[model samples]
Target chain A: MTDHLVEGVLAGDRRAIARTISLIEDNGAEAQATLAALHPHTGRAHIVGVTGPPGSGKSSLVNALALYFRRGATGERGEGGSPKTVGIIAVDPTSPFSGGAILGDRIRMRDLAGDPGIFIRSMASRGSLGGLAWATADAVKVLDAAGFELIFIETVGAGQAEVDIARTAHTTVVVEVPGLGDDVQAIKAGILEIADIFAVNKADHEGADHAVMALRMMLDLDLGGTATVLHHGRLMEVVRTVTGGEEPPSQGPLPPARPSAWRPPIFKTIATRHEGVVDLATAILAHRAYLEQSGQLVQRERERAAAELETIIQQESLRRVLACAQGEKLAALIDRIVRREIDPYTASQHLLGG
Target chain B: MTDKKIRVLIAKPGLDGHDRGAKVIARALRDAGMEVVYTGIRQTPEMIVEAALQEDVDVVGLSILSGAHMALFPRIMDLMRQHGLDDVLVVAGGIIPDEDVPALQAMGVKGVFGPGTSTDTIVRFIREHLS
Candidate 1:
């Protein structure tokens, strides 16, 4: 069965692809077997991430950009052309209060409907804290193995956690809308550093220019001494001036990290009108080329793999720890905690030690 | 490793502006410990099939009130077959007439619920059929 699924997915069979994703989502032994069987066929598609604050028109932008991408490819790559097959994964937040999701992204993405070359899926966050589903990366691998040249991972635009997309996509596009009172504040700090490109969506709105200016100001600040780096287990800004050339000056105490060669470019777009969508697509392709030329593609992949490995270790260790503590002892510990006989930390330590 | 929650895709097909019923059904399904993917408003048969495939949903509930059941349901069934969704349980709810329900069932739709039907009835039907 795993072999058949691997074969079908490699051949771009829609049913097989769907079934494989389902299996992965279920987290069954078959899912692990299927992923292992198809491991050799993964890692071809360029994963692009689209994220922004709610009501930023990110879905519309993704829809319009997907249309442009679909128009460019004819099932294979050209001499610098659009991709043939496109896949969309829209991650919508599940309500913590209700465990329900609206998943309205498809309402904006209906234009690509009926196109055999395009496959769109809506995923609920499923209580994952990072604005993506737990099985999302697995799903992307399924699409990649299915031969989609370009795959878009659209995250639920919920502020800080959306930064997880930077670890998932080859190129990340941060979207913003005008007339939202705190437009500048919305893209502050952690969220600002993850952008590979910026799309000022809903550009036809009244304060579009102002939003663009705010984003430009932020990017400029980022370029001037606010460098992005993963340091001490966090994304930190290293303030360093470039003295002689593109590299930071080595004269004083060495800056923690070097400045990135690529500065995110901003594009104004009215996604609903399909205006400036071509420019957004162009910028995405250019960024891919830049990543390839700079060898950052391999680096980004390593970083993503490292992150995945850490998550697996963390989750697996916890699952085993909980399973080991499952019956009377665990219930007694919980009851003690409820009765103030033990704190959660001591209970967890006891559980793990046992 | 088992997926405890049943996932269902509730979709509207063919230019239907009425989505109150669809929303209600989606909410009911969610309340019944099911994960429902509501593809809001205006969806095509192709879109519904594609969503069903990607979501790996156990069932697809079509909500159409535009009086295009004959044209839409058959096309959706064909698409589902083409997409290898032969085993997916299909149900329909909305302004579907009593006469059309037979044709819909013949086309492989498992159940059809019409106007004035209780949400509990729809939920129970899905639960029983899936079980």
Candidate 2:
């Protein structure tokens, strides 16, 4: 059964792909076996993560991009390029109070349906805080193994928790709508570091220039430093006099964690109108090219592998420990820890028979 | 193995733009711990069936305020059959009248909810059928 399922998924069978994802969602032993079989055939597709806040046109942008990928930009053979098989995994939040979700990301993406070249699946962030379901990465792997040339993972876009997309996609595009809040908010968004490209969506709205400019300045500071920023105001003259224009001083005390040659570019877009979508898609492909050229592809893959390995090891170790600490024994042990008779670390060690 | 959460696709089909009842039922179903994929207002039957296939939903809740239930329900069911979605349980809600209930039920709508129907009743109907 597993072999047949694997064969079907590899052949890009629609029902098989859908069923494989359902199995992953179920997270059963059979599901694990299926994924294990499909694992060797993975890693061919370019994964891109699209994230932003609610009402930021994240779905529309993804829809337009998928359409562009499926039908091509010019609806023809060249320049905008040929159509590629695309897969999309769009996620919406599961209500914390209800533990169920209204996954409506497909509403805006209605245009892409019935297209044999595209497969879209909507996911609910089933208790996962990072705007992604626990099974999303595996689902992407399923699509990748199914021979999708490009797969887009659309995050739940739940603001701060949206960082995990960076862990899943080679390129993360953060969509921001102008005048969402204060202009300075762009500098505060943690997605700034995760973003390989930023689309200032709703660029037709008020303060689009300010939004774009603010994002530009933030990137300048993030990519280069205050020197790049200092080349602007009165700080330029002061810096020139301070260092004699030799090498501008550092922006902050802490340097960037991982220095990259790629600077995230910001594009003004009105996603609903399909404006700037072609440019955004081009930039995404360019980022993929850069990742391959600059060795960041292998680096990112290693980081992802290390993370997945740690996650599995942690789960397995805990499972093994729990096997020794049966129900009442675990409850009593927890009570003891609560009373300060023993600490949690010591209890864990005791369970491990260490 | 733990039981899978029931996945339901709540869609508003046809020319009806009024989706308040659909949303109410969707929220109620979610409250019962079912993952509901809502294809918002003004969805075509084809789109609904396509969504059902992609989402692999256990149930489909169609909400149509327009009196096109008789006109559209058969086509939706026919499409579902054509797409091999015959196993999916489908229910409907909206201004469906008492006189139309039996006909709609005969067409495999399973459940017909009218105005003033409690969301609990709808949720319970789905639970009972699926269980």
Candidate 3:
């Protein structure tokens, strides 16, 4: 059964691919076996993560991007005559009270369905807090092994700390809307740091130019383009403000830090109208080129592997300790820690020792 | 709670602009620990079947208040078969009449829910009917 399923997945059988993803979502023992067989065939597809706050037009933008990849900017195949097979995994949050979710991202992506070149999957963030579901990585591997050239992972409407998409995707497009805030809602350290491209969707709406200007101003600060900023209508010490009103941390007898060469380009878009999406798509391809030329692709892959290893180690160690010392034994350790008889670090050491 | 959730697709496929009943069933099924994919108002049969194929849903609850069940169910049922969705338990709700229930059942709609029917009944019917 496993060999047949693996063959079917490698051949990109639709039913087999769907069933494999379901198994991954269910997290059964059979899933591990199947995934192990499929893992060696992964990493060919380019995974792109599109994330932003609620109602930021992420779903529509993903739909537009998918359409662009499968068709093109002019609604026909542009340049490359053959279309690229695309896969989409859209996520929404599960209800905390009921442990259920309404995965409605498909509603915006109605046009992509029934197309042989595209496969869309909707996921719910089932208790995982970091923008994506627990099984997203595995599901992406399934699609990757299924020979999709490009895969887009759309996160649940994200907040500042929900930047986990960065670890999973090769190119991260941070979607922002106008009037969200003065400096733009995507300007937070977490959000700004993760963006390979910034798309200000809903450009026809008011405040779009201002939003673009705000993002440009902030990126300029990071790019060392300006020493001053118009903050609250005041000219401010940008460097000091960036350093939290303190002197810059100095590295004694060391070379000064240099900025990364690739700057995330900001694109204005009306996703519903398919406006500015071509430029956004071009920016994505350009970013991929930069990553390849700069050798950052291999570097990022290493980082992702290391992070996954660390996470698995952390989870497995905790699971092992819990399996042996659950119930009163674990409760006693927790009670001792709470009573200040033992610190958590020491408790962990003891747990590991025994 | 079971790790394997019962996924259901609740869709309104008709000209009915009012979908309060569909939304109600969607909410109830969600609260009952099922992942409900509610494709908002006015979906076609092709769209509905495509969703079921992708989602691998255990049940598909079609809510039609436009009184087009006889006209729509056959196409939906045909498409479901064409897509090889033999194992999916299909049911309907919202403003269905008593006399139309037999035809709908013969067309492979296992349950027909009408006005004032308890949400519990719909839930129980799905739970019991799904293999």
Candidate 4:
């Protein structure tokens, strides 16, 4: 059965692709084996991440972008010039309080339905923070191995973890709406650092120019362009006021901080009207070409692999520790900590047999 | 390894614009610790079944207020059977009349919720039936 599944997925069988994703979501031994079988077939898809706050038209923008890519002029193919496939993974919040969520990203993407070359899956956050489920990366791998040339991962909500999906994708587009106040500064302070491209969606709205200017201003500050320090300093004062007169806490350090030779470009788009979507798609492909030419593709791959490996190691170690201390052994350790007989840090040491 | 969460798909089928009941049931199921997928309004029977198969949901709850249950529910049941969804429990809710309940049940829908039905009742039915 596993062999059949692997072969079907390799053949781009939709049912097989869907089933494999479900298995991955289960995070079981079968999923591991399936991933092992499919690993070699990955590294071919260009993973693009689009993230923004809820109601920022992220889904609509993604819908338009997917259509643009799917309908784009056929380019070089894997071998025989077969049309490219597009896969979408839209992450939606699974309310922890009720354990329920309306995964309505599909609602905004109704236009892409019934296309054999396109696949869209909506994933619930499932209590995982940072805008993605733990299984999201694995799911992307399934689509990649299934021969999707382009994959779009739309984040559930805004946060560091959500922005972290950009870490896994080749191009990360941060979508923002007009009149968001300090929210722009918050993203500018945190997630915007990873943005390879910025799309100011709902460009038909009133504050679109202000939003684009704000993003350009932030980019100028970091990109060392013709940005004047005095002007930037005044903007920072406004940022402070918007954020309650305080700078957001530093995000420590991260990639996209090393002054990459490539600078993120901003595009104004009205997603509902499909305006500027083609330009956004062209920019994404151009960025991909840039990464390839600069050999940054290999660097990003290494970074993504390192992050995935770390997460696997952390999860495995925790699982092993908990399995070793199941039932009364675990209860005893917890009770001791609750009784204040030992600190949690010391209890951790004892639990690991240190 | 023994902990597999119950997954449910709550769908509004047949051009029904009233999704308030569906949303409520979805929230209730989630509060009961089930992973619920709400396919928004106007889902066809084919779409619902495809989603059920893709999401691999253990149960499906259809919410319809457009008075199209007799036509829609049977088509959904037939499609589910065709898709080898024999093991999945099917339920219905919203404006369904008493006379239509038995017909729907005979067609393999396990439960029906009309007005005044509590979300707990629906949740408990799913737990009992699926378990």
Indicate which candidate wins on DockQ.
2
lDDT of 4 by residue, A95-173 (tens): 7676666677877886776577888887777778877888899999999999899999999878543566766788988
The positional error of residue B44 in candidate 2, measured at the CA in angstroms, is 2.0
Candidate 1 vs 4: which has more lDDT: 1
lDDT: worst 10-residue window of model 1 chain A: A241-250
Q: What CA root-mean-square deviation does each model show from the true structure? A: 4.4, 6.1, 6.4, 7.2
The superposed Cα distance between candidate 4 and the true structure at residue A18, in angstroms, equals 2.6
Give model 2's DockQ, 2 decimals: 0.65
Residue B110 in model 1: shift from native, Å?
A: 2.2
Return model 1's CA RMSD, one decimal: 4.4
Alpha-carbon interface RMSD for all candidates, in angstroms? 2.1, 1.4, 2.1, 2.4
lDDT of 4 by residue, B1-131 (tens): 52266888889999869888888888788788887877789988888887777677889999999999999999999989997888899998899889888889899999888988888888889989977
How far residue A221's Cα lies from its native spot in candidate 4, in Å, is 1.2
Candidate 2 residues lying further than 4 Å off, grouped into runs, are A74-79, A225-260, B1-3
Candidate 2 residue pairs in backbone clash: none
Q: Write the per-residue lDDT of candidate 3 for residues A1-354, one digit (tens) a residue.
A: 778878988998877787788788887778889999998999899999999989999999999999988888777754456788999999999999998888889889977867878888888889999999989998999999999999999999986889889889999998989888867554556666677788999998899999878776666556443544432123433331221111232322312343324556788999998998888888887778866876778877887888888987998788888898889978999999999999999998887888
TM-score of structure candidate 3? 0.89
The number of residue pairs in model 3 that clash at the backbone is 0
DockQ of each: 0.56, 0.65, 0.55, 0.40
State the fnat of model 2.
0.68
In candidate 3, position A174 carries an lDDT of 89
